[model samples]
Target: MTFPAPIDPPARLLMGPGPISAYPSVLRAMSAPLVGQYDPFMTATMNETQSLYRDVFATANDATVLIDGTSRAGIEAAITSLVRPGEKVLVPVFGRFGHLLAEIAERALADVHTIEVEWGQVFTPSAIEEAITRVKPTLLALVQGDTSTTMCQPLEEIGEICRRHGVLFYTDATASLGGNDFEADAWGLDAATAGLQKCLGGPSGSAPLTLSDRAVEVVRSRSRIEAGIREEGDASADDFVRSNYFDLGMVLDYWGPRRLNHHTEATSMLYGARECARVLLLEGRNAVIERHRRIGDAMLAGVRGLGLDVFGDVAHKMTNVVAVEIPDGVAGDAARQAMLTDFGIEIGTSFGPLHGRVWRIGTMGYNARPDAVFSTLAALEHVLRRFGARVPVGGGVDAAAEALT
Candidate 1:
């Protein structure tokens, strides 16, 4: 039979929101030899990975582990496991991901409540507190970074609000964890989930999650109470989490000292995920955040130097992504395609309300460097000129260079 050629895709500088160019070391880790699920080496690697992520999340929680799917999988695992059917889950909507949280919770059969701030804006702690007081939800599901709007919601104060209201605080930190400041323990977070594709500098197959003692207690209570009911044919409890694969109780046990079996470990992805964390920690977590801040700032300055207006409130923008308004008469998708097909660059476009109106450019992960930022701006300047936008000769690149220095 005729065979397809070796899969070779074009080299792209993925300057979009995620799945950015992973670190060279992380790529190498994925190609390492595989091992048995129960191998001592594998278990030790798992323990080491958990330790690395504790440093990454800035928490000492013993329940840190990886969810074996995309960042969305991590989000689902957290929501489905924490919220029981018909229990209230409060979601404050500010962007596309917020709606996703509500949708996930609803599918889990939680009574989902959502209050909206306008797109491009974030909810204040007082706003969240008021809602928590009124709705009295069992859990507060929030997105720390919403790339669709390029907003990084301030989580430090919201954590306190959840604590005061006796609500479990959970955040989807997939896009913001390594790039911004996330103090899981200090922020009073009960649970949090992150993906390796963003600032962690890896592919999207693995998600790092951490659960505090308070969250772990809740998970254990449900699982322990319903442990033997299945065998006794007494389905009366109905409290076991709806999913075995996503059940944190089983997942924790698998990662814990018991070495119980759960999902067949995706060994290669784990390797990549571990390396991602390792590189971040080696460089120092705060240093990585500062790097992202510097690069993202340069990108922002570059766009404005090109005479582009930024989308949303600049004060609340993420440290890794900036949304710039598409110039009048410039076709958004055509410009994006030109950047891809003509320059092999991939800058993202907004979703929903902001779609076609703005371009979301990201400086994150391995691509968050001055050279990458400069190259992208130079190419973007050419693309803008092609679309008949009046772009200055070297305005973008010059501005970005100035910022970096």
Candidate 2:
């Protein structure tokens, strides 16, 4: 395949699972010249980044930070560091990402137990309480939102249950953090991980994480000092963790005043993550969440106006994204292809049992705008009609306008 010299593509809307529209400021931050990994100025910026992300995460924990990889890295770091081998971890499976938590726990040699829920629904506080009581797990790992089926799991009530049972509650907020209302400390979440690509309006290369004092204790108990960093007079520490790279003890030491070397911190990605949190904090967390809520509601109304059935529990739907059923007589693949090729729009298809039955539409981060919502609906209306799906002319746009207003 031959590629032409760079030419800018037309501004097409992104309404997919992730890597949604990034803010111009974040892009510009990435383009700035790089500095040495251990530069004093870089460390100062890193400290500031942590401070900004603390506000974004709504936590006062000093351990709040950005990991060098994508959202999954944050999850792995949190899991591998917090869950020691032979410890029981209770996971309630509702979507694909819950399966991810189970798999990661299994890799960690954890005694994993699962409470399965039906697709398109979430677990109740009582259900999780029963699981925790039965398993007596040391850790509870769950996802705040699973994009595979467009389901947002209720976390506040579940967190309280974990707290009561003396279980360390951990969550992957990759798809929901900045898009919804999350109170890390108030809700009793021991640790939470997120990606920059979702509602933060940044690239996917950075993962932000926060941990409470309970989580810090877990890490401190398992911490291990690096061999290279040892000195003649220094004695070995038993609290050292197994994995050198993912060790939060090492990371915290490096991030703290010690200024030791860990990974050659992704300098530009740090800038991007910093700006992402700064932008969200500047907008105010509640206001940012409200913006996503308004736009998501508009998108839902637009889909309904197009005569399509919205999937999942509408009452518990996430503020950042939505799921809609593929109407009868129209090929889901054909409609999606038309939306991509003709309208330059990108949406998502579901997985597992919902495969070929639902279309996932997202209104997240920089794309959460009234104009973006209307444009996507208008394009989808035309595409649906073109595929023999019955849709009233301008109905989707009209409904979305009313909802946005």
Candidate 3:
């Protein structure tokens, strides 16, 4: 049963939660020839990648580095290494990814305490502070933006609250990093993790992470050195990190001047991640963030022009994504499928309780362009019309174009 190796060039609109339109420069960087892991050039490339990510993460920590694998890998590395079993951790669940943080902590055998809000709303800093006061959690785990409901949880106040409570604050910024503002040091974020796939305009294989000195101390105390790498009578030989692969302790050593080997580094993905951060830095993080804001505004106005109601409190919507309420009697999945199959556009749907009830449209990464904003709007309007939903022809695109202009 031989299958035809047909041309796999799929039509290219990416208005989704993640993997949103990789930058052409990033793709080119990935295609560059790979070098040996210990090659001088490769070592330099690793250093440069870490430096670039430091700027993107807005952190001065020397430990800022990339974790190979997806965003969840970064989450696992940050949590498993920093949180010892029985350490109390507070997690506030605003959406799906908050649940993910709780799950990771539980797997690490952390004493986890969680406070959940309704899907679309965010927990106030005071609410989280109260929880922290009650639980006396040593680590506070949360997601900056949960793409499931297109909500950007307020972080600034929460970070300060955690500081007062003596809680090390950690965040998963996978869906929000490049498109939104984050200050690792200024916000008192002890540790933070993000994936390159979302707003970073790169592939999903690398997760960028930055840890404050306090967070680093936690990792250092729990660290265990593997036997093979240890020297006889070495003072640090006994500190074997709990999870060998996801150990930030070893990862930092590998990324540091020691340049030790943990695994075969994902060279191509590192190149891609480096280039992604380079592009973001060149554009200026604040400008890139503003671009996402403008595109999201255009997309939101376009969705409204199509006679659809947007979900969530508009005041708190994430800068890179929007959640639109699927109108009554309109088949959300069918319209999404039609838009994908017929028009070659990909918009995302919601998750958890809002699944099938809302459409999560992304204006992020390379797809935050004006063309993508209008094309997605126009395609969505056409698909909704086919489903007998009364969307005004040309109105959506016109509105988007107006905003984009």
Candidate 4:
């Protein structure tokens, strides 16, 4: 049998919307020697990680923990655990991720209701309130920042609306957490979930999530009932969550003081997650967010100065990603290929409605820097010109440099 060669890979600047370059320290953290899941040191690390992410979420909730899968897992866990079958779930659809939330809720046997805006626009608070009044769903699941359309939906006022309507509020922050402002408690989020791969400067796999006391009450209700039944030698689990793997209550117990074993922890991912939070907190959370904001603005300016029209409302776009219209007469995929092959840089292709019409460029995590921004701008200029598009010789880099200054 033939074996593949040792994993040698090319070095490419990841300027696309996600899974950007992980921090070097985070990579090293994964190489640290593993230990037993219940070892004292391991448990302490887990507890410390929970505290670190509390500051990251800007929340005081004691139920904060890490989910074993990707950000999607966190989403499913929060939704399924909180809303039992046949409960009403309202999802505000702005882009692809919103649709994902609705689909997940539907699979959880929820009576799903949806409200949508145009791809590039977001819903007004009043619109959401109106929907809540009409649909009166038990839960409102929304996406905070969706990379698909480069839109960050304003969540502050909507939380209050959900509260007034007595609806549980949850948001998927996978695309926006580290790069944009997110206040879980202050914003009255009943549940919020995020992944490390975006602005956290780490690889995907570990999903950090937090739950409010109310959400916890709902989730633990099932656990209490199921545990009681199990102790009585009853095998029935009619009241238990459908998914054992993504069950947030079980995950919380494992992360909590009980140390109730669920699955064996992903030791390396936990290390990487801990280092990611440490790096963010060490640098100061607000400072890292500012860096993403600065670099993202520069990338937007660079694209504009390079003679590209940006997609979506500029005011609502996230701080780490921008979508630029694919210039007429230039093939989108071909230009992206040239950017990769010639310059060893990768910018993203659009998703859903924006596909083939625009390119999504990201300045996130470890790659959100002045040098990375300028380098991407420089390469983009060459690619656009080679594709027979009219672009200024140094317009992109010059504009980005000016923005940085």
Candidate 5:
């Protein structure tokens, strides 16, 4: 059988829920020469990356580090290490990703309890607090932004609530960080994890994570020395983390001064993650978030101008992603295909309850620009019209441009 010729892929604009176009600098950084895992330069680069992500996470926690896998790896690492078997964990489900948190916790053998709100809505702080009080959970795990519904759960008050209730709090900020407001220390979050593929402007290989002192203590208590490096006096716990690769205690040690052997770090991914954080910090976190807000507003206005209704509560929607209802006459998949084939643009489809009902469009990372937003709007309008939807000519682009002004 013949294999494909030398690699070549079509150039296209990614305007989907995630895995958006990475910043050019991030791509370049990943192409740099590889270095030995414990090389002085490599360790220094890792430390610098940690420092940069602390600013990105808006925290001063010394436990901040990168997990050498996708964002889900960080999520599992935090849950598996911090939540021992039989521990109660409360997850407030608003959309698909909230369910994901519960699933991960369940796999960790946690006594996971979940409270549900509709997919397009978020849990109120009071509602989540009530659940916490009733369940008396050891940890409250939630997602800050669930791209499935384009809704961002309000975390500021929830964090405070968890503190009052003596429940450790963790949030997956993969889709929200960099383009939204997240204060790990200020909000009292015990642990938080993020990915580079969304608003951070990089590919989806590295997970940036941060843990407060309290969360670190929980992990340290369960720390077990790796077998190869185990000494007589080394610490080990009876109930060690289930997954070796997803153990935060060992991961932290590897990233810390001990530099104990764990997995061989993904060096290229480290470079990309470092560059992603560096670019965001250089641009100023607040400024980058505001840019997302403006671009999101423009996109929202453009879709509305095309006579499309938005899903979920507009006030609570994520700044990076917007879910627009598919018009009655338009075939969602066909329209998406037309946009991709004819205009070289890609938008997202929905999941679960929202499937075939809304198109999840993203203005995130390097693609969160006025030109990108405008082009997407224009292309979408054309597709909708061709599919027999009554979209106003030029209205989408016009509204977007006006919103920017």
Candidate 6:
């Protein structure tokens, strides 16, 4: 049987919601030679990655480590390890990803309760607090940024409220971590998870996770040694984490001083994750977030200049992505495909309520730049005009340029 030639894909400027182009440094790092899982160099590299992610997550938690999977893996690890079956968990839903958290909690056999606002809006602190007070849940699970609606839920106040109520707080920061303002320790977050694919400027294979001391305690309480590493006195919890592969207790031990074997670490992905954090910290966290804000602002203004209506409550939107309403006559999917086929660019489509109504454009990771933003705006204008929508030829690029200035 004949097989295909060596894999090659087209070059594209990814101006979509996520999986944006990775930083060159991160790509280079992934090509480094593989090392043994317990080699001195490998363990040291793991330790260094942990320290770097702590800085990136804005936390001092000693249990900070990378999960050897995508961002959703981090979320499931945090949820499955922290909440035993039938434990009450509260999820505040504002978008598709918020509903995702609730769904994951339910699959963990959690007694999940959810309070929701409209798709394009975020829940206020008071609303979340009211639900928390009524439910008296053991954990508050939420999403920091839900790209489906291009909304960022303000977490500082909600974190405070969760702390006062003695609830363990966890958030999925996959789409917003490096590009937005997030304070795991200061915001009273007990557990937080993020992916390298979005704002971290790397591929989607690694997930950086951090756990506060309180969250660590919760996971440790459910600790159970794997059969391969069992000792004479080892004891398992009455309700061990359902998924062995995602058990934070075992993962923590492997990442911790014990170095107990869990799984052979994905060495290349770990290198990429390390470089992603290094690039962010070297540039300074605040400066990277500021870059996202500036570019995101330009993207937003550019879309508006094309006579497009922006979706959601603009005041609480995320810094990395924006949702623009689809024009009356333009076919949403067809326009996006044209942008890809004709221009070698990619833009995002929405889900759930926003589907068929809005397009999600992103300026994030390595592509969060003046050139990328301007190029996307220019392409969008051409596509809109070709689709029979009225748009000024140079309006999008001109507005974006002005915003950058």
C-alpha lDDT values of all predictions:
0.93, 0.88, 0.87, 0.92, 0.92, 0.92
Q: Give the candidates in order of TM-score, highest first.
A: 1, 4, 6, 5, 3, 2
Candidate 6: tens digits of C-alpha lDDT, residues 364-400: 9999999999889999999999999999879899998
Candidate 5: which pairs clash?
none
Least lDDT summed over 10 consecutive residues: which range in candidate 1? Answer: 224-233
Per candidate, the number of residue pairs that clash is: 0, 6, 6, 0, 0, 0
For all predicted structures, in order, the TM-scores are 0.98, 0.94, 0.95, 0.97, 0.97, 0.97
How many backbone clashes are present in model 2?
6
Q: lDDT tens digits, residues 277-396, model 5?
A: 999889999999999999999999999988899999999999999999999978999999999999999999989999999999999989999999989998998899899999899999
Q: Please tell me which predicted candidate would have the highest TM-score against the true structure.
A: 1
Query: How many clashes does the backbone of model 3 have?
Result: 6
lDDT of 2 by residue, 1-405 (tens): 998989786776789878798999999999888999788789899999999988887889999888889899888889889988888999999889999999988887889999998888998888889889999999999999888877888887877888788999999999998999898888889999999888999989999999998898888777656344443344354334556778887787788888778889998999999999988989999999999999999999999999889888877788888889999998998899899899889998888898899999999999999988888999999999888988999999999999977
After superposition, which runs of candidate 6 have C-alpha atoms over 4 Å from their true positions? 226-238
Error of 6 at 370 (Å): 0.4
- Tell me how far the alpha carbon of residue 122 in candidate 5 is from the true structure, in angstroms, after superposition: 1.0
lDDT per residue as tens, model 3, 101-141 = 99999998889999998888898888988899999998999
- Give a tens-digit lDDT track for model 1, residues 202-308: 99999999999999998887674336544435545557787777888889989999887777999999999999999999999999999999999999999999999
Off by over 4 Å in 1: 224-226, 229-234
Give the residue spans of candidate 2 off by over 4 A. 1-11, 226-240
TM-score winner between 1 and 2, please give it.
1
Model 3 scores a TM of 0.95
Error of 2 at 14 (Å): 1.2
Better-scoring candidate (TM-score), 2 or 6: 6
